[model samples]
Target: MCRWMAWLGQPVLIEELLFNTQHGIVDQSLHSRMGAEPTNGDGFGLGWYGSGEGPGLYHSVAPAWGDANLRELAGHIESPLFMAHVRAAIGSAVQPTNCHPFRHENWLFVHNGYIGGLHAVRRDLMLAIEPGLFADVQGSTDTEVVFHVALTFGLREDPIGALERTVGLIEAVAEQHGIPDAVQGTFGVSDGSTLWAVRYATQGPARTLFASSDADAIKRLHPDNPRFARLSAEDRLIVSEPFSDLPGLWHEIPQSSAVTVRHGGVLEHQAFTPRVPVSAAHA
Candidate 1:
């Protein structure tokens, strides 16, 4: 349904990752090999960490492959952390507000999934959001709602737990509505520092998720490839698909799992289990 990529580690011009790679986001926008649709041209967004308290955002209701503004800004911006996405609208309209990398304070979130029967349960889920956060709902996509739900459940203090609750709430609500296939997708979240991702689905196999192998691992895999050699050990990429065909350079995150990229490629992996937060049941 969408394509996204995240970068953490050495500071580099955004274009290097967004435009320069052989099968980068731009390429994915036009010819994604793994998304539900090959083309994710509905809209696009960028969220990057620079010299600011929170990440920067740029969204457009244009196809990512042809967005000149994105190319221009990417050519100039250098960030230590970056989250970029090219969307393929599911049940929502193709609009800027519905773009990925939805932000809340210092956090940014992107997802490639849907809440089954969202139109039916949207009202119930909206009631579940904390009042303070409820006002921030500006888009009608299930993705935006998921981001806010995570925030309502404590994204700042506990991302994994918050997402667990977020998914749990979605599943519970889906059950209430008799929608057996509750959720399916991978979620990426960042707080201007570490990058985290969850690969999950309620009733089937989760969507694809890949993280760059350790710098050393990549070097060993492609011993003489300078492109792999130049990157710092800290530089890591988490993407929907590997940007290139280099074998062993990308590790597929397992189903029902969570990964954290931090401290220079010291990837942390954990089994993800979702349970409804107390509020989900009542709301």
Candidate 2:
């Protein structure tokens, strides 16, 4: 239902991602070939970490392609780590609060899938949130709730575990409501220095996720290509689809998997599964 991209490595003007690529995020806003819905015009958001305490956020209830202000900001901002998302409303209001890369302290999250039967079981999920974090709930979208649920489950300490628990909670509740295929999405979360991306579903294949493989190798093949100049060997990208149609440049993350991107250009992949809490049965 949406398209998003995250960058980690070298600080470059945001337009290099928002506009420069052949089919960058801004291009996907109007013609996303891989998203469930091709047009993600409902709203858009950008989160970037500069020389600040945390990431800077810009969200608007306007299409990414149509917003001149977003373009202006992208041209000026340079960040080593950042996320950009273009949204397609799925039965949710097109308000600024509902647009993503939702933020909590220094963490930012974005999703490209929906929770099934959310209307039937939203209350159950909300009540599952730790009271301390529940107070931060600000919108009606499932993505925002999922982010908080991850936080409630100790995302600050273990992102994979928190998300496993988060999805487990979503699926367990969906099962109680007799909802089929309870979860389907590719989620991306970052804490300024590192990024964690997950692709999972209860009964079907998770949504699309791909990461650029070995920027250094790509640079060797096209040393004159300017895009490769600003990026370090460790700089990598996790995107909803291949940023461009370059052969062997994008590697698809396996189904039910998580990819972690850290400094020094390191990327690690691990199989992922939901962790059903013992208390969930009683809840």
Candidate 3:
């Protein structure tokens, strides 16, 4: 339904990942080979942390490929951590607020998935968002709601735990609405220091998710490449698809799994299951 990428590590111009990579998010916007749709032209968004208080956000209803502003911004902004996404609207309207890479204070989140039968259960899900966090709901897309649900469930405290709760609740509600196999997609979230990416679906396999190997290892493997030398060992990237076909550069995240990327580039993989269990996620 969408395509996204999150970068955490050495500071680099946004262009390095958004535009420079062979199959960067920008390219994927129009020529996506892995997304459910080949083109994610509905909208786009960019969230990055600089020397600011929180994070900087720029969103638009324009296709990423045709947005001159996006190109210019990417060329100018350099960040150690950021998230970007291109949308291919499924059931939501195309609006600036509905774009991915949704933000809240110091956190940024983006997803490439769908909540099955969202319309049928949207009201219940929205009502479930903690009233305190519910005020931030500015968009009408299920993706935005998912972000808030995670927040309500305590994403600020534990990204992995909160998300498991978030998904569990959604599936619980979906089942009540008679929607089977209610969730599908890959999700990425970060708080400028730690990053979490999840791949999951209620029934069949979820969409694709991949993480890059240590950049230093890449440099050693391709010593002749000048680009590799500029990368730091701490550089890490989690993407919906490989940026390139370079051997040993990317590893696919397992189904129903999550990757935790710490500030120092330490990577941890773990089996992520619905905390609420299918039949008892709800009281």
TM, every model: 0.98, 0.97, 0.97
User: Clashes in model 2: which pairs?
Assistant: 234-265
Question: Could you tell me the C-alpha RMSD of candidate 3 in Å?
Answer: 1.7
Model 1 alpha-carbon drift over 4 Å, by segment: none
Taking the candidates one at a time, how many backbone clashes does each contain? 0, 1, 0
List ranges where model 3 is wrong by over 4 Å: 277-283
> Can you rank all candidates by TM-score, best first?
1, 2, 3
Would you list the C-alpha lDDT of every candidate in the order shown? 0.91, 0.91, 0.90
Global fold similarity of model 2 (TM-score): 0.97
Ten residues in sequence with the least summed lDDT for candidate 1: 274-283
| After superposition, candidate 2 runs with Cα above 4 Å error | none
RMSD of each: 1.1, 1.1, 1.7
Residue pairs in steric clash, candidate 3? none
